[model samples]
Target: MHIKEGGITSPRIEPRFEQLESSLKPQIAPADASWKRATLTRQPRFNNVVARNWRGELPLWVSYWVIGFIGNLLIGIIPVAVDGTLSGHGYDPRILLITLAGGWLAIAAVSVWQGVGVWRSADARIIARKDLGRAAPWAILAKLAVFVGLVRLIALAVNIGAPQMTELSRMAFFDDPDISPYALRIMRNGTELEISGGFKFGLNEDLVRLLRAAPKVRIVHLDSTGGRIGEAVTVYNTIQERKLITYVSHQCMSACTVAFVGGQQRWLYSRAQLGFHAPTFPGISAGELADATEEQREIFSAVGIDRSFVDKALSTPNNSIWLPPEDELLRSRVITNVSDGSNFAASGFGANLPRDTLAAQLKKSLAALSDLERVAPDEFNSLVDDFLEGYQKGQTEAHLLAQGRQRFLRIISTNLPLADDPTLIDFGKLMIDQYTFLNQRDPSLCYQYAAKGELDPFLLSPTLREREAALDQRVLQTAAKRPTIPAQILQSLWGKVISAVTLRVGRDNAHMILGTKVSPAQYGSYCEATIAFYQEIIRLREPEAAELMRQVLAPK
Candidate 1:
């Protein structure tokens, strides 16, 4: 408690009061010697203590960098964890935003705490005071750099791993049901089977199982908006292998058209729509996309569709659907028939009659007519003469048959009158045979009938008609002695003649004709002959025949 000043001694005093008085006393030193004097007098050990303390704590820039990096890392990881927890469970997007914001605010609070620590640190305060504002700005910049670098690292990691993680999360949290999109139902009293809806992965297996269970199915009706191409190809192969007829009464798009093109006999309703497009897969690699495209092209080519059609389908972008016009459908031979739904309910094989019994009756009637043609040639000739005379006056084979049918029915009613009598069948066969013979004897008769717009070509079953058409084309191409009429013109005339007959007799009546189903080949033979004869008359420059041919050949 003694005081000494300027090399002189002071008197001693009470220790506690003297200590307080000494603590309040002030001392001054030269500016050059201030640091040394303070270091020596104000406890020189304090500098070492402060240095040791600051050594345990980090430098301000280092501390800020570490804090910012950790804060940003927490900000990144928290959101990712929250996202994984709630992913694929249909959580609102705002939940993720809120979680990220909360984490960022926490990081910012930590940064502010770190800044306060730097402001309070004895060494940092002294250094900051000496360096003016440079120290704080440099520390802030270092922290900002560390924060940005950590955030970018998190973003890179997330970008690289998000897809796989998302897929795994979805599988774990939102597994889908294993239900098929397609449904198969037997229709038209089990003669036809209707397949509806999208073509899912396992639809082909379902379709094949249904088909195996229903062996009687001859027609497959399609109603779909398309789906997996692999399943569609399987269905197409099954349908083609079975030789089943395919009918589209509604929308058939994308892969659905693949199955449609595989039909043994394809048919379309007037209002039905069929669309096509190239295959596509999102998020697939370039090589994988190329492979898929090639596979699709192969499938289309294997179906034997026109190359142009295949090209159009392939060239169309995957996002868009190409619905070709009806004329293109017909020209491409994509459909063998176009229906208006009128015959759909009743046009299946033998839908309107007992098939086996009708076949037997028709065979018997055909035999009886042949016997009559041989045994009573004179009576047959007289009946034919009367038919021809009636036909010439009425200008229609149906009219001629109607006039002769009553007389023939009256003649047979007395001899073989029974509830199941074959009289009508026999009479119809006789009328058809008479017409066939007359057409053969006079090549001009077809022209005359065609001129009057009354050419009545016989109807044939789809199978028989397609076969005959193929044979006709082959014969035309390879025949050593070609007909005077070109093959194209002959085909054109044949199509017109058949169309006219179809319009005249009505589709239902034409389908109901026993000859059409029972003896389709024979019916087709007569039609081909009639077409040839009509073409010959047209070549000979008959004005009425030429005019009628022009009208028939014009685009419908």
Candidate 2:
């Protein structure tokens, strides 16, 4: 099969097949083999490098999916659920919402950083460059969209589970009976102790301990809806003993009011509220109720509170709280100061009135009363004895007299008869004057004054006085037939007269008496003299005759 081009015959045509077969087999050069070997060596190593790079970024990708999406979703949902569950349990929802928003932002920021890091990696950049025309923008956006959608789905799941989660958490955390609702703090450098929440049994002990630990603590800031009458009473006694100040910046209600009244100096913020209601002993027997009523009356009475305030508190049903008006609070002396968290000391009652100044003022008041000589000798003497006793006990004469006057008025008012007759009004005025003289010759009692059509002894006309005398005879005659009438009905009628007289005297001469320049001891003596005079007059008149005279003063 070999053809010779020259004249020489080809050597061995039979063996040409071998040479042809050899030529047909492929032949490799050294350079070409070297190039193939080099390519094979580089390809696998390049793949390995790419795989390592991806592995390095795997954690970031995992984080984006788990923490960014799932974790964030849970964070947002947890608070929402918790807040929902605690809706009425005193948690603020806005706090939860803020927490959720913060969590989401933190997660989103981390996810974006990680995703960008992956996109900027060497392998990723190479791939992106190669796919620039085919899948650059849309593919990246689609991936991001998928991630975002997953995150949204997680959020949706959280929302769906929120209600149930909230309920579960609430039951777990809030409904536990062992947890106390009260919060106590020693604040303002331990000069103030704040008590918040319901008054529990241990509160009194806690307060005592706090007071002992920080003897400098002069202020007890009360914010309570009130609780346990017995505990409140204990607190009140402690406060009174320590002569501590009580302050209400928010709410003081029910038994809390009792504590507030016990303060040596009581203060209330403009926005603060003091609520009162009749004492309640749920499921108690009638006997218990009666006892409770008496106890409450005694508490207010001890504080020099008027019958009106007591009546208002007692009339309010247990379930309802009576929030007295600011004016009422001021007038009742329940809150001696209304402050705005500044200058409390300066604004407080008697804060500006030095003891010496008060004593001087009281003396002047007594001197004026002594000049009148209107009170009976015996009553005046008794008043003097009481004043001296109080003074010896380190109580200021003015304070003693004020307390006595307030107590006397309260007693008379509580027992006063409800009558519309002018003669009764006149008689009431005379009785009030006599009582005022007996307590402390408040010169105001000598002045004529009546409110709401009631008789004011100080303001009574001679004709009215005569008529009152006539009514007294009639009352005595009636009382002879029914002895109980003198103690119950006639006594009340006499009490009304006493109340009217004292109210007028106090109203007209309060400033004069309280701010007088006389010495306290002298003022006390005058008060005693006036009281003694009134006492003698009553003794001379006899109870039935006095009561009869009171009735005679009532208008027909």
Candidate 3:
């Protein structure tokens, strides 16, 4: 089998055309038949119009449009053919096109079906299933074709079908227990979660169902204008698992308010309202129980808030809790954003005001209120009486009130085993109450007049006046940071009033003392707090004397 120089080594060659010619010997050709040329074409695996388009046969879209248009043309011509008339826009163009294409495809499909039927019926040529080799390649090819057709389907029906399924999921905040619809997907953005429909029964169950269905969902509570306490608690439990954020777009009252406070992120709107009173069950009664007892910090942490933010929220009540502007909410981690609404900012009348502003205003107003309580004796007493009346109602009116004032008093009286550190003033709350009653009855008695030297009339060991004076004295001592002479001069007195410093009394009378200083805002800054007097003598910080202040303020 080795090839030498020019010798030809050949393999066998046979004429394969003769075998097919021998097999078709019975078929006769007509004398006039010109030998027809035959060619093999590769029919595409995917034949449907949309399917072909999906397989990169994008021209089919134009074809579909054209065919639909032609179909519409046919429909439009129908009236002309039948009654010599034309159709207008009233005719559905889409339906006409689909109908026409469908009819054409149906006819073509029938022709192919009949030919296949004739081939299968030929007795001698009927191929056995096994002989066709366990389902032809064409069968697998058909499955692939069907898949392509399904994915590439462009009919209005298929497009229309999808949105109907998605509509249910779009409403994540909405709850409806009456019907078992799909749950929505959501997250805790600084975004608002608004619920459209009003409240209905079984809302708690609906919310529970939602959480169970989508455990990973982040939380957002929009304007929940109060709701069932029991239901709110259940919803809160669901939210606590992830420490989900809860928001009150404006007002979250009663049960909902409790839930908001429990949130990892607490929020308030500029226009938001927070109503008091305990959380309650709807249509059911329970023993009188307080709403929330633990400190604000613990509640926030238990619900997943980072601890640092809880500190700020609790510390600044009106700022972070009540009238917290949106910016502070973000800084304090109470809320992430305003989402969409009038931002949380203070306004005139001061109802919806910023925290710092509120604090300053409160200090001024309270100072005034305290003075009015002393000066216009009757008017001041009535004002205090009004405060006490409101305080009493707020603490006792509702069965489920937090009752801070009462609880504080109880702790002071040692009637309550818990709450070791009650506010210091609780010991004389009764005395204050008596004063309130007297003021309400008479309205014009000065506090000293009301006391009328009976300050300790009960034969108590220490006289009431003596006790009051002792407390007042202690207060004054605490209020003074340094002795009247000034801290720098405390050790050098040598038992004598110095001649270098004159001990002269000011015009504020020999009794009263005052301090004054330059403005804080100007370049030459100072304030009244820097100057003071002690023991009827005018005393001032040497460095900030009148001449020095004049120089600091001069044309600065």
How high is each candidate's TM-score?
0.34, 0.31, 0.22
lDDT of 1 by residue, 1-556 (tens): 0001001111221111011122233455345677877676865344442333334244553344444345445544554565464455332323433443354344444434444433334255345444543334444444344345445544533542343244333333443122235677665556677777777655677788888888988888888877766567778889999999998866789888888888988888766788988876433335446666777777767766678887887789988999997778887777778865544432212212343444344335334333334544555456556654432232223454445445543333322221121222232233344345445655344323323324323332344334433332232222232124465766676556555655655554334332343233344344434444334334433433433433332333
Scored by Cα lDDT, where does model 1 land?
0.51
Model 2 per-residue lDDT tens digits across residues 1-556: 0000101111111100011112233454445778888887876443443343333333333323333344445444544554364444332223433443444444444334433433344234335445443334433543454455446545533543343235334434554233235556665556777777776556787788878999888888888888767668888999999999898876889888888888888888875789999876423434446667777788877877777888888779999989998889888877788865452321111212344454444435444223212323344345555554553343422356465454433322322332223333445446545445433434333321211222233234555555544544333223222132345866665565445435545533323333344343344433433333334334423444344444443333
Global lDDT scores for all candidate models:
0.51, 0.52, 0.34
- For candidate 3, give the lDDT of residue 198: 23
Residue pairs in candidate 3 whose N, alpha carbon or C atoms collide under 3 angstroms: 346-353, 378-443, 456-464, 517-528
Clashing pairs in 1: none
lDDT digits (tens) for residues 1-556 of candidate 3: 0001111111222111111123335457444423333212345666774343334342322323333244335534432332221123212223323443343343334323322222222211222223534333332333333334334332322333233223222222243332222222222221222221223334545655656666654545544444444344555555665576665545554445445655665555444554434332211112222223223345556645556655443344221334445565466554544433223211121122344454354335334333333333455444344434432222211211123223322222232111111111221332344344334433323132222312212222234434433433232222212213353543243112222223343332212212232122311111111111111012333322322222221231
Name the TM-score of candidate 3: 0.22
Which residues of candidate 2, in runs, are more than 4 Å off? 1-180, 344-556
Segments in model 1 whose C-alpha atoms lie over 4 Å from true places = 1-180, 343-556
Residue 498 C-alpha lDDT in model 3:
27
Ranking by TM-score: 1, 2, 3
